[model samples]
Target: MQKAHTSFALALSLFLAVSCTNNKDAEQIAPSLSAEASQSSKDGILTSELSKPIGMSIDQKNQIWVSQSGTGKNDGSVVVVTPNGRVQTAFTGFGSQVLPNNELGGLGHVLYQDGMLYVLDGLNGRLYIIDVSSYKAKDAPVPASSLNFIAIKPFVLSQNLSNPLDSNLYDLTFGPDGRLYIADAGANAIISVNLATKALSVFARIPNATPTIQAVPTGIIYDGSKFLVSTLTGFPFVTGLAKVLQISTSGVVSDYRSGFTALTNLAPAKGDDLLVTEYARFVFSPPVVGWQPSTGRVANAAGTTVLGGLNEITDIERINPNFYYVLSTAEGTIQKLKY
Candidate 1:
């Protein structure tokens, strides 16, 4: 890739020609979850007490990789949890380019495929590619270092600490078309990353009036066909305006659900319809909307309730054809949910 800096076509072709290796590790680690893990109200905490953790994805062995925010520049890190629930720090960043509070920037989300890991460094407007395989010539992954860290120009927004779009990057999911789909919340747009060339582009942008307050996207996924994006609105994040948008491969955007208040993530349920998580309900205060500790919940495709009383969930993963797991960023936990 370093050499390809002189040859764009060579880089893109080499990247596009390679199919993502389906390294079995992307699925469940166990043939079957244990009895204790299968309980109806299962609350098996995979990892807990994290420092402002946000995004996560599973690897070949069902080890959960999480993006954790640090207190200052260069403190953000990526951590992993084994199938048996042991946690390990995989790597960290040198720090973000801008920040006012600790939570706004850092390594925000992670996407794992085969032995490769893609991390979004929101503060610096860059993407870090890490080699997760045992034979990586540089040895195992380490903090503040990477196999590659490519700069994304679009994410280099106003470093003004007051900019509401500061959470420049949010969630990420791999598209069947061999690209990475990213939720650029601050810019009110969905971005696509060319894996081969490490190029960035605005795939789809919400046509709303205020990107600074209205159209922050958080969660995104590819359902083997089209894409679904979740958006957050207003600061302290109000309840009414947040929603999920249906995005086409050609960059068309439309509302999939408009009634959701403080929506965080989306995933297909074990049965029919889609499953969504709400960040919080509306209440009175200067921060008109805020997270209610242990109050997040999930709903079905038709906007009907399914599960309730969760703790500030940011992402969800369906591990099988029958069950799913949700991430609580606040609680730093992952709990299995049976739909």
Candidate 2:
């Protein structure tokens, strides 16, 4: 069963490689933005000292917290970046492993709510909780040894399912009921956790994109009423197949939108508008090594491109009506945009 789990992980790793190229080439892919949308756009804040940053969240203090999946050596960490770009490590020494395809997996996503920081360990199904209410931007790093974690894999394995050998606790969001809903990429399902009891349950099983392609759930968000999930469709990634799913608070899953390729994350925009990350379009043919450079994009619910030419964009955070931050894993930088 463990071997089966590793195989599933290796397949997902093929699509999670972070590019090391600069964003200068990415700007050329899509040179045009809407006149109103292009009012002011500039890469903001932290650019250096990032290692395969995957997940990001903003707190009440307006502090930006980012998770780095490290160089696949158990060096994964979560850092707090102040509004002025001062970076400080908050937690260190999480599990980081290099997959068979050379992709790194470790800290998956970070969520800050109230006074606690919820972190997901992708390589090993676990959730680490830290009290960051009193943590300042200049405070020293918090070692993982002092934090408490909840083992999620054992609970996932206990549930009888068709494909239950593996569990990759990826992106997560707080549901209306105050439970933590996690997108398990390996199991292809949403797992809900009761914070009060630390109990786990399979909330909903995501259907495959096609007859053979699994809808690997990547990022999730709660929009007051329902939960929205983004998927990175399985191997041999077909263009225009990836989509966002709508899951009810009661656990019913249905399609919300389609015609996307390699969707990664979603964020609420002005009014009912939604911003989604199109991670990247992969290149499988000869002479093309991996994903097409700068093909990644930030699009709306209607499939309209808002920002294009991004490289491996994994997360998007909206700060206010006109301000936003985008995390480009490949570029290892946070891009601030005003619309």
Candidate 3:
């Protein structure tokens, strides 16, 4: 184990963006663990292979909060990491173990605004709100009551949806008008939840996707006027079909740009453009875990490479005008990069 603020350039594997398995017969991308294959940092960058880090956000105090979707039910947790790299537990032990098989909720993306922390429970199909105003930083679990979780339906594992994949909640963001938008890969729809009234409804769906394939939405970001979403079409995510769409506030959805393979996460970049990351590369074979060898790269709005040769870059967080923090899922560490 390494301490905070240590710099070591690593080229880690960036795994899949959305972490839900819908079809039992579907191929699972569960790659074998290897620090040798993973912890290959270089060029003097700070790295720490935190466990299952997915969603991230910088709070008002500049503290980094990462929601880690642990490998099992009842294992999901969140950690508050400083920009300098020191890590501490924000909360833990919140999900319940379901009956029959002990299936538990998996924590995915997290958003922080004002004094509230919003966490998307990807596995359990619920959302959680945590107020960190009085909580002190420590690497220990807090009271489960303090977690403030809302149980959505069982959206994963044993979800009994009309469409099996409809239960996959991949990403979430808060709009300027004070509403939370969610990206559901299983249903390929964007759902919104009103925090004040606890009202949930379908915001939009794939209005122009190929009916033969599943155009699942993975990542979503509110960019002033509209919400930009990244969609993954079909089981083995194809390049041409992995395009970003712009959804209006009234729920009108349309394509914005293309030329990505298994696009997973999206973020607002400098001046009217966006930063998108690919979960995997254009592999000709069926999707396997960690098959793309540093095939992932970060691109600008015009499909130009900003950071090339990445290993499954899952999420990108802009710290300032010219600096960003990229989450390399396969490497299990967050690396700093300048654009």
Candidate 4:
């Protein structure tokens, strides 16, 4: 029954990806993507080219690994691009096959650790761990393409919860405490799973807010003592209520910042500061458009800031002591922000 539902959801997403462009007008329907930095803060840098970048993580080599959930079929793939904007290698989705009129390779999120690249399959509730050292998908008993892959291996994590409904884990990162914190967007909760033991626990469940569907959770990070989670109000109007919540190790969640909408991914930098990627532009959805300047922290904020001009910020990472690099999925370009 769950597999059937997942198939339907994937089909719908693929449909949206195809007609995403203005079919009647035959024009790509991206955000207005204004190249103007006029309305942006001095901190906002403008650029395009990040290619629908959704998930990101820094490898041991410090290069940025990006996953492109393209706008349509033939657009999805995994890219290993250097900090200097050079494409190293590209891996196409499972096979070259694209479902008839369906989008392919919607590779959503990625994690690079312990010489392995773990990709969370958004189309299905499955995890694909690639051996970074081998550059090949790991040798799972189910051949790496089967939807029934989970039962084939003992690498599965165990959670105490009796109910196992699909939550569609999105952005994930290791907390300061070394536990894996996953944005269980389907359930709007930040899930903490012990990496060493795979014991799972619900760290926090997002409280209901305006435009109920926008309650979808996205990015997450930990800064020594607290965990920060990003929210994208998945509604049809301008609620402008997306926020980042600060959760303690004990699992107490609080609204650390509010008023902004559709912030997707996040990363931590120096001096108690964090970087966020915004994904507010949608045509079949919202009307807001254009390249707003790459907005992020110039200096560590005492609290989160509710501002604008950030394109679909999908990922971030601290390159050096006070310098951070941000990836804009909408623009396909990276910004180097100096704090």
The Cα error of candidate 3 at residue 51, in Å, is 0.8
Tens digit per residue, CA lDDT, model 1, 9-50 = 111112112221011112222244545434423355655646
- Which candidate has the highest TM-score of all? 2
Runs in model 3 lying further than 4 Å from the true structure: 1-44, 94-105, 143-146, 154-162, 282-290
Candidate 3 vs candidate 4, TM-score winner: 3
Which regions of candidate 2 deviate over 4 angstroms? 1-48, 162-164
Q: Between candidates 2 and 4, which one is better according to TM-score?
A: 2
TM values, all candidates? 0.79, 0.87, 0.79, 0.66
- Model 4 lDDT tens row, 58-119: 55555456776655444455667543444544455432224454534355567776566656
Candidate ranking under TM-score, highest first, comes to: 2, 3, 1, 4
Compared with the true structure, the alpha-carbon lDDT of candidate 2 equals: 0.75
Candidates' C-alpha lDDT: 0.61, 0.75, 0.62, 0.51
Clashes per model (N, Cα, C within 3 A): 6, 0, 12, 20
In model 2, pairs of residues that clash are none
Lowest summed lDDT across 10 adjacent residues in model 2 is found at: 21-30
TM-score of 1: 0.79
Whichever of 1 and 4 has more TM-score, that candidate is 1
User: Per-residue lDDT for 186 in model 3?
Assistant: 55
